[model samples]
Target: MVVDVVKRCFRVFKKANESTGKILGNMIKVQELRRLWGICHMDWVTGLPPGSDKSYNACLVIVDRFSKTQIFFPCCKDDTAMDTAPLIWNRVVSWTGIFTNLISERDPTFN
Candidate 1:
């Protein structure tokens, strides 16, 4: 009888926990496009076969979220954050101006 009572209490607690853990009305807020190149989607394509010059084994892909414009910058596979930031700052930022938002794959280069 003691075991049965404990089992019933455990079942009640499990049900209560299950009900309390659920989220009902939370929704993800979508970003709205406000200007050209306002939101930049950035990613790196690594492990690519060496190009004809053999200097580049990776590419930094930057896409404009608003206009769907894409830019590919050839880069080395082992480039660190220092090497990447300057390339984007000089090449991409110079061309498109400053962007408000940047979406990335959270690679080490962005760190």
Candidate 2:
């Protein structure tokens, strides 16, 4: 019964023909589209240095979609937002000349 209900909902959703492309088509520019496509699916991996102190082993990763450029910085676990912010801004902003959107996992230490 649950499966049938789910199937019916899926059919209705598929038939809806939602057209987001039309809405987004005009506003986005070619450069903007290229930038979006460049960074749309980039992944970064950062972790502690080998046997580094747990209190200060966070990593910084910056990815630029347009150029597929990346930079990595290793920081201490005890670093605060105030400390990390400037380091990130300098390295990432200087390299990309634009502030890349950051998607860092919430650090409990920041609390």
- For candidate 1, lDDT tens digit of each residue in 1-111? 999999999999998878655577766464899999899898989999999999999999999988999999999989998898899999999989999988886687656
**Candidate 2 global lDDT:** 0.56
In candidate 1, which residue pairs get closer than 3 Å at backbone N, Cα or C atoms, i.e. clash?
none
Q: What is the lDDT, from 0 to 100, of the residue 7 in candidate 1?
A: 100
Off by more than 4 A, model 1: 1-30
Q: Which window of 10 residues has the lowest lDDT sum in candidate 2?
A: 36-45
Instruction: Kindly state the number of residue pairs that clash in model 1.
Output: 0
* Model 2 Cα lDDT, one tens digit per residue, 19-88: 6564534443223533432342222244656445555455556656566667767766566679877886
Give the winner by TM-score.
Answer: 1
